[model samples]
Target: MNFINGPCGYFNMIVITSRSSSIPIVFRRQLSALTTLPLTLSQTNKNGQKHDPPSKINSPPPLGRLRASVVSPESTHFVDSYLTHSFFSDELKISAKNGFLSRGRQLHAHIVKLGYYNVLALQNQLLHVYVKCKVYYDACRLFDEMLVRNVVTWNTLICGAAHCGRSFKSNLNLGFCYFKRMLSEMVGPDCVTFTSLLHTCIELYDIEIGRQVHCFIMKFGLCRDCFVSSALVDLYAKFGLVGDARRIFDNILDRDLVSWNVMVYCYALNCLVRDAFGLFNLMRLEGIKEDDFTCTNLLNSAAIYGSCELGRQIHGLVIKLSFDLDVAVSSALVDMYAKNELIVDARKTFDGMLSRNVISWTTMIVGYGRVGDGKEAIKLIREMFRGDTGPDELTLASVLRSCGNSSSITEISQVHAYAMKDGFDAILSTANSLINAYSKSGNITMALDCFSSIANPDLVSWTSMIGAYAFNGLSIEGIELFERMLAYNMMPDPVAFLGVLSACSHGGLVYEGLHYFSLMTKIYHITPTIEHYTCLIDLLGRAGLLDEAFNLLTSMPVEPGPDVLGAFIGACKVHGNAGLAKWAAEKLFALEPSNPVNYTLMSNIYASEGCWLDVARIRKMMRDRCIYKVPGCSWTEIAGEVHTFVSSDKSHPRASEVYALSELLVRSMEEEDYVPNEDFTFDHV
Candidate 1:
């Protein structure tokens, strides 16, 4: 039989399958050598026939690379084995590139059957294919079987362990241990090895390990490498060490685009808007082109500073560079306009986009919500559902916030149902938003149910539930839950303590409130903010301890803000403490001269004590200052639409019908002998 129909079917398989026209000329010549050579087999075939080997077989002339290994007496056979091994290695690389694990395994099986399994080069190639396909366990097994390994062998496993998409800590530890083994084996690392390890440190937020890696790079003089220095910059930037990051970035002898982007991102991450803008100007002077990432950071910085004019300039630059079509840059533009309260401009950009991701849709939805346009926000959400991209957890949370602001109970319920169907309810942010939405919709029971659904309630979870109870006036339940959270070893944060203190203030738990305050300050070492002091003062004043409340206010380290004084004034009105009420009202008036609520509360306090002259004086002061109490606005959702009503507003379409219904409710209240407090009317004085 000819070699094409040879007894060794494995060589024929390799020649037929991998002999593509696109393969290089050198490989094609080697493949031709395999088929044209007259082969002989020493082993017996399945038919129990042993073929005789040729004694004077000549080596192929084009196989000079592997010709050095042909020094053995069986030169032709050895050349065949080397050529086959080389072809298999190249094919394995292609398999790895395409992530074809099955094809890779078949090639591996062929290698083992041909008795080339112990070849170091072939084993390393197989290990690489497994790692590329993410079959890490099989890669580890193959690695353990190899008796001899090179630096490539150790580097493959190290990089694979770092990026296997497992637990962050576990992956970092695994990569670190592999590096230790590599060092113990006297295998020095290259630039690629250190770069991967630094990336793992960045992911794990282990800055200490990153520092150690930096030391190693310095010692090995690899700090001059572009990629290694860029990684070090990213590592320091993530930890907010801007000075260190800049030092490394400046030391880079050959600064590439990635190095410049890292430094710009570091400034942006730290909110140094002027510094970031300055660098962008320098980069433009250097004539280095900016990509979508660079523009996105600059847009974010402008949005944070509320520099709408600067954002417009950047928007012009985006169009000039044709980056306006990029989804990330377009999304940043929309966010900039939305945050500056230019909703119309934001809408124009959203409408002009050719394609959009979930972030694009969510940014537009949140923009409408920010401007109190919940109808438009809800409409976009429906349109998003009809498209290819659906809402993520953040999208759901933003819509939930809009619904809560409008008190749209029906919409909140619909979203909660959708969350359950789409498996987003388990996300902590979505779950917390659900709790707050239900609480704001006046459905405390539903909020409690949502809170109980969390499998692992984090700190935000417990705090949301506590605030829900406080908002609904279920203070006892809120306190019990707070205690339960403490029992579960969930350390209460400042916001958590604020929630429980508000609960105590509403429920009149003076002793418990003082104890918790002491616990927060003494045991937890949390400094009390103005809100905490306000809650404590309100709690004391409500129980008729006006002097004690004033004492605490005076003893506070920080000056009292408007909210603190307002709460104290409300408590004073409840207890008829006009003397202390006047002192606080004067301080509040000085602090906020334009706020009409402070003057109203002070006038009401005087009217209740029957001091008509003082009330008239306060009214005259308001009139002279052109101060008018802003009308309170309330909204109710009806049939999936929100209707807003200001106090005594006559602009509603059905104003006559609303007035008639209001009169009917008032007459019924009168029939039941309900009394109205005349002193409360002085708030409108």
Candidate 2:
């Protein structure tokens, strides 16, 4: 029998043919010399018969490298044994790389028989192989039994434990314990040790521990270590301490490409666009070429700053550097264009990408949703499903948002079913978005069901459910839900408070609205924003307190914005306070001169008060300014199709039928003594 040596170890005995009989002799001799095993090339086949080797077998070189030694026999023997162990280690690594765990175990057994099991270097190699195979338990067991250990041994286990992605808290403690033990053993932790520990802190967001590690590095005068310093920069930057990150970066005596890239990323993450660009320019001046990381970070900053001009420049640079093909850089570019309201450009970038991941798809969906293009966004969702990139929580949430904007109830229900089927209904973000969608679609019962489905609703969930109640005119229930939220020890954020205030305003609970407004600022320490003030003004105005609402608007710390002024004008029209109506209208017109609603509001108020001359003057001003009232439009969904009708519109395909039916209904109502209110009709001169 002839045996061929596999890459990892020697094969067992097999029959050798006459043509290949010579190769086994030399190969066996080399194996025997290396492993100290006697050569036996004969074996029985599975059928209990001897098998002959192939007729045309090629002879290969020896499996292991052996060095000549001029030392004593004992020294030469040790060198050869070490070289044999190294050969086995390399073979085991190759097995691990190929994911042949069974072959790796076999190689491990061979190393033990060669009397190198206790060798520190070989043990570390085995540990690495086990880690590569994701058999961390076995690696830990081996680590516990090793009588001899070195820094490399501990570093391997520490780094592996930190990156194993299992029982993070336990592994983190284990890694830290190993570091502490290394210190007690006087093994002297190196740059690799600190970098691993710092990374763990980064993942855990344990800033205090990371700070201590930074101090330790400084104490040991290892501050100049580029890798350690770069990790320190990352640690600080992640914690939002960009100043400290920059300080550490500046202190690095010898900065590498990683250090520069990290600092640039740090600046970008903090939204310091000018500083990031300045440092990037400095990096270029230093002759350091830009890579994908640099471009991605700069593009993210451009997105945050909403600078499409800067983003275009970066996009040009990306194409110049041929980095546009990089998925990460391309995703960043898509996000930048989407945020800047350049949806066409965003679509162009997304379409040009050769490959896209989940994030890339989600970004485009969100872009379309933001522009209220519900049809386009839903189409993309279907395309995503066809392409096998199933929608995740973010994708579903964005699609729900689009459905809400378009008031597409059918689409909302379909997406909600998909969420339940995909088990994403349990996620808080999806649940909140579902509540918002159902509420906007005028299905309060379904919205309530979605709210009740959450296992442990967070603040956002509470706020969304409360808003659903408020929006659907269930003000009492909305207030009760807010109280329930407080009873559960849930702190109300600005949005939650806004929901309750809106509920109070809608319910006409002036005292409750005023009380909560005070409580929000005094008890919760939440600062009132323009939305809150607008709600308050509307509440006062709705209760026939136009003067009080106007006074509140004037007393606001900040200048009354368009929404606030618009709310005040609406109150004037409601209460027939034409004097205050004119004042609010002037401000609204100045703020939004082209908005026809302001002119319409003023003309309606004058006509209501029988001021025909004032109404004519307002009409003339609108005509001179070329502003026309935007016709009021209402839509209804029938059989999953939306039918929209503008006031006095005659453009529908079945307009004559609709108008005839309307005329018939009105005549029937008049015959039944239904009196039409003529007070709201505008009289033309």
lDDT tens digits, residue span 519-635, model 1? 999999999999999999999988888899999988999999999899888888888889889999999989988777788889899989989999998887777775466777888
The lDDT of model 2 is: 0.81
Give the runs in model 2 whose Cα sits over 4 Å from its true position. 1-214, 231-245, 582-603, 610-632, 665-685
lDDT of 2 at 178: 83
Off by over 4 Å in 1: 1-167, 586-594, 606-630, 678-682
User: Which residue window of length 10 is worst by lDDT in model 2?
Assistant: 60-69
Model 1 / residue 346 / CA error / Å: 0.8
Best by lDDT: 1
Tens-digit per-residue lDDT, 1-685, candidate 2: 5443433343332434345232222223223333322222333334434443324223321333212222333322212232354466667667667766776777677666544566666677788787667677788898888887878888987787677564466776677888888888888888888898888887666899999888888887899889999999998988999989989999999888899999999988888999999999999999999999999999999999989999999999999999999999999999999999999999999999999999999999999998988878888988998896788999999999998988889889889999999999999999999999999989999999998989999899999989999998899999999999999999888999999999998988899999899999999999999999999999999999887898899899888888888888778877789999889888887888877667777888898899989999988877877546667778887777678898789999999999999999999998999988654554432
TM-scores for every candidate against the unseen true structure: 0.78, 0.71
> How far off is residue 386 in model 2, in Å?
1.7
